[model samples]
Target: MASPVSQKLEEKLVCSICLELFRVPVTLPCGHNFCKHCISDHWHKQEQAPAGAEKGYTCPECRRAFERYPELEKNVTLCSVVELARDGEARVSGTERCEVAHGELCPQHGRLLELYCEDERQCICCVCSIRQCQRHRRVLFEEERSKKQALLKESLEKAQEESERIKQAMQELEERTRNIKDSSEGLRSVILSKFTLLRKALEDCQWRTVARMEQEQAAALGHVGENWSLLKDRLDILGQHRERAQRLLACPDHRAFLQEFRLLPSPESPEALLPVEFDVASVVEPIAEILTNVSRLLLEDLPGSVAPKAPEPVGQDHRNLTFNPETANKYLELSKGNRKATHSPGTVCGRQEQGPRFEPWQVLCTQGFGHGHHYWEVKVSSHSVILGVTYHSLPRERQQGHKFNIGLDGGSWGLQVREDCYLAWHRGQAEKIQEPLYKNLGVSLDYGKGLLSFYGLGERTRFIHSFHSVFTEPLYPVFWLCEGRAVMLCQRD
Candidate 1:
């Protein structure tokens, strides 16, 4: 190994910006030395930075300011010393790098890795950059690090959100399981009481019918059990990812962080939550065929899950929605019946601000839903429209860096209809859903069940997506219209 004194001299010859040994060393007015090209490139980037002042030729190391760009003088003495240090160290330890070889050194080149190779997905040294990866995509290690750091944060956020969704689903599944068991037992009691008044022959039929009902209960419970296991597995995966991401985010060493990030596996895409409904009516209807007409009468009065249920009428809960004019932005125009909203920048809806009007190009519905099944339909002229439900607590003021603030927080959820896909936005995270554009869209809300679904209206209502969450307060339907986009609330008698 080379002596520690030579290693210290080599470290002194390193440029702070490039973190590499000086190439063509130059001295600045601030008494700091750096590579000639490195100092020039730094000043060039400073000039191109936005909102720069008249003069900003500041030294990166000492932070000393200069009125004008200073002339770089080649430090011939320091350059000669750096060369002697390298040659002396080479002779002291033949073909062995002293200090740089200890950590993050190129095994083949024996140089400190300063650049990141995009094509190879690894950090590379100076020699590797020109020799093997000259034509490959190369960037500064810090540049690649910042970009990956952003992605790491985004992935962590998604894991937290998915974990919450799975927990809620598990709770709902347990509650539904309990209700099925109670309803099935109540029906058994009714059948047993009816058989006691009949002869011994009827008692035999009662035993068989009760056995069939028990079998139906077991089958329904088994289906729910399978769904519960699926959600459990997904929750475990998200939890592990969240823990690892947190640790990586806290890592102080950029090299170690980047290395671990490359090896981290991506979370799997979430699966759709299957609809949990058991057809109790079909199982009970067969008993009518085995017994007298009285058996059919006993089945009619069965309650809840024990009885046959008619198909829920989607139209019965249809809501007539209208835009709240006071909450509309200046660029949005409301129709005479307040059923249509059109966005046109040239034509102002109202110049003066009225009430807590939306600063973003958005509007809120006049009605809010609290506790029941509700369905509504709307026709959009084109894409670039956002329709969703939000709480009244949503800020009515302007939002920064965003055209609309519908799904930027926890109080709101939105489905942005893009030209090629749909983006489900909640809590500032967007989950993209790819689907063909549909003009007529339907929104269904089951408040008691904590389900909100969106559908595309065509030959039949096509199920697009759904969000399950326990909503605390009443939700109002909100909308945003881009320039030249129009949304009309479809009228249904």
Candidate 2:
């Protein structure tokens, strides 16, 4: 639907380098039109002239040297004319006249044979061709023009194909980007939800632990305060009795009053006062029992089931086994069959001893406290036998804890404590055995005449001046130290 001139103008207006409509059109002083960006980029590259040449550079099309700035700002009349032609408004005017001989059209081509040289002004008809032109070393205008047209046509087709491919690629890229955005949004939502749940769980755990600790602290304070009040009342009564006795002695009836005072019973010895055992069993035992039941239920049932759940709370029991140092000597003596004839001690049952009164102790059970590691402290009193601790459930090669052969060279007696407060002692310095200390506690050792005591309950064990006696027996409930170590000690109650 467009005129031929308009189409031709559109084709010519396209940039030779970019093969697109010219943007920021500019012209060289020689009158060749090109996109401003394209020409300037080309000029910038050539500005650094070849070696040994003048610093000034020349136009690529016209070979005319001009100042750099002015050349860059040259008016582009040809580009404007081409644009107008594309819009069907261009007029051909003020152009150099075509130089043809006698105004005759060429015989080979109907078009006028215009002379392209600036000087010499040679003009000839197509019929009368010059021999110099036929055999000329330089390229003829007609041949050069034809070659340029063919190259332009090829470039136009290639550019069109490339543009189409780029458009398709852009569409695919947009689609993929949108999908990635959607996936990112979905993942963000899921992470936020999980974070919220975890925060709430953490808050609940904090509040529960705080409440339990506060209750225990309050109960302990109240019990201690009551004991203090009772002691104060007893002291007051003793003071009153002492004052009355002093007054009677002053009155010369001291002997009679003394007799009356003797009728009153002596104050109870503080040593005889039995320590109050709060029997935390009521509170802690149920939880432990429940956890044990839960463990049994879980272990007994098959992996897949749909029925009653186990009593899982037993798993929370973290009480560690502790040893009594005084009992170690008894165990060592029993292991050596050296009990005195004066009294018969309890029988030592379990595996028979193959060596000289030394055996290993086995783990009875293991309780886990899911939150963190737990600890126990044991003390040893006498070291006449070997003592050791191990987790039998674990691999044999992976046995852990301390073991010592006591009294081998008549060294000072020492005590060894296990991860659980289980204790053992020897009569002499034993071989130093590295033991894995509990995660949250420290170990302490004390030695006295024929007694060696060890403690492992963190820093607090250092402050414990006294201990309450509990039931003690042979290694029936616990394991035997056949290969590792064991100690002899008297059973305590």
lDDT of each candidate versus the true structure: 0.80, 0.41
lDDT of 1 at 81: 70
Clash totals for all candidate models: 0, 46
lDDT of each residue in 317-398, candidate 1, tens digit only: 9999999998998889999988999998898866466679898899999999999888898899999999999988889886
| Model 1 alpha-carbon miss at residue 199, Å | 42
Off by over 4 Å in 2: 1-154, 248-251, 254-493
lDDT of 1 at 274: 59
What are the models' TM-scores? 0.37, 0.30
Model 1 segments more than 4 A misplaced = 1-314
Minimal lDDT window, size 10, model 1 = 304-313
